[model samples]
Target: MCMKHRKLLTAGIGLLLTVILIALVRLVDAAPIGAQGTSIGLSHLNQFVFDLFGVNMLWYNITDWLGVAAVLTGFVFAVTGLVQLIKRRSLLKVDREILALGGLYIVVIGLYLFFENVIINYRPIIMPDNTSPEASFPSSHTMLVCVIMGSAAMLINRYIRNKPLNRILRAVCYVIIGVTVVGRLIAGVHWFTDILGGILISVTLLSLYEEVISHGK
Candidate 1:
């Protein structure tokens, strides 16, 4: 098959995986919230983690801030992609593709929201006093970090032929993803399935985005 056909096939597979993950998450929801399951948050694990890591005082505060930071970084990329597209409107090659990918990203997220409502009604069940808006089962914040930050790192590595620098940037990207995933897991704010769901869905979305918009028409 040609490159375009391969890309389309890849995108289809990613989409299929996303659908399967959503179904799996819903099936898992058959277990009631508070029985043997209890509240699935990581309060205890996080507590011990914070104490051991010596960051208990700061973990909660930083995690809240990190959520905002992660989203804003995605916005930065979307804006930059748009600007680049406009700057090269006449040419409209890779820049245009990047901008379209950004748009596709939003669409995938919209579907994610709709699926959560219809499938599991998975809303982030946070503490009563917490201020952040509730979104659950596939942490959108973590998903955003994975796609936006991950894409940025991919772009940098693609452009920078320098091996050492590319490796460093990729490593940083991995670190960000790792910290965000672990921090959420430890904080006990999100059920572990919520995070696993988030990661699986995010990977599927990112994969589709790459297969489709990252390649040319």
Candidate 2:
């Protein structure tokens, strides 16, 4: 199959997986097992994982900071795009990959806001300073880290001429993504299903981003 077809197929699979995951979380063993007795989807499995790992505030904070770093990386790209626009005096003259990255970031932010308002399940434990459990489904931190770093890794090769430097940057992005995903899980802030959901959505978004950037090349 052609590359375009493959990209679409991969994106479709990711979306399908995300839909199936959400369905299972809602239908299977869901109960009021979350913090302060909030209802949680996939309560049985979520409870099991939470019990096994327990809560680690240190890991939670670490991953949270890493997520911030990912966002800052995206911010750097946004600034680059803006600088290009000002120098070229035309938005169309700005780097297409950077423009595409900007669009992807907006979508990521939209998803984050959407999930914040729509409660799927609450955190396993109440966060500090919060009187009650907050929405934990899709693990926003995991999603943010994966999408931002994953896309950055993909784009780095296009912009960086130094092969060794490009490799190092890509490696760093992968490491940060790995640490955030695993740390979030180990921190016990989100259910297993939440982590899985975040991963699936990231896959979908990243696939689309790849397709767009490929067309520009």
Candidate 3:
């Protein structure tokens, strides 16, 4: 299939997975875990995941710090785009791909807010430090790191003419994404489905971003 067709197909699959995940969450929520009516999570795997890794303060700390780094990286990219726009004095001249990257970040943030506020899925284990039972489905950390770092890799491939440096950047992105995802899972604070949902949403958003940017060029 053509590149555009492939991207469209992949985007569709990603969105489908996200919808299915939502349905699964609702199903799980119907069966509350305790008298408090706290949503349990994906019925089959939630228990297994919790039992496998009771709780790891170290993993929690690692994931939290790494997540902050990812957010900062996203801000850096946004600032880079704004700087380019300022220097060029034209949004079109600032690199259409970078604009698309900014748009992608906005979309990711919007989704984060919508999911967290509208479709609340409390974390599997609430930390004492946290004030509220923040939504866990479609993990914000995994989604943000995946999109921001994933976009960084794409930008590096497209613009960073230095082959060695490009390779290094790509490797670093891969390592960060892997560690963040695994760390969140191993931390045992979020349900397995939450991680899965994040992966799906990230894939969908990235695929759509790539398709739009490719066509713009």
Report model 2's TM-score to 2 decimal places: 0.97
Q: Which scores better on lDDT, 1 or 3?
A: 3
List model 2 lDDT by residue over 115-190, tens digit each: 8998777888888888978998888889999999999999898889899999999999999999999999999888
TM-score of each: 0.68, 0.97, 0.92
* CA deviation > 4 Å runs, candidate 2: none
lDDT of 3 by residue, 116-177 (tens): 77764677666767755667777888999898888888888998899999999899988899
Per-residue alpha-carbon lDDT of candidate 1 for residues 66-115, written as tens digits (9 for 90 to 100): 66765776677677776776777753554644665576677757966775
Tell me, by TM-score, which candidate is best: 2
Estimate the overall C-alpha local distance difference test score of candidate 1. 0.60
lDDT of each: 0.60, 0.90, 0.82
Distance from true position, residue 100, model 3, in Å?
0.6
Task: Give the number of colliding residue pairs in candidate 2.
Answer: 0
Question: Cα RMSD (Å) per model?
Answer: 5.5, 1.1, 1.9
Model 1 misplaced stretches (Cα beyond 4 Å)? 1-18, 28-31, 34-60, 90-97, 119-125, 128-135, 213-217
Poorest 10 consecutive residues of model 3 by lDDT? 28-37
Clashes in model 3: which pairs?
A: none
Clashes of each: 2, 0, 0
Model 3 misses residue 199 by how many Å?
0.5
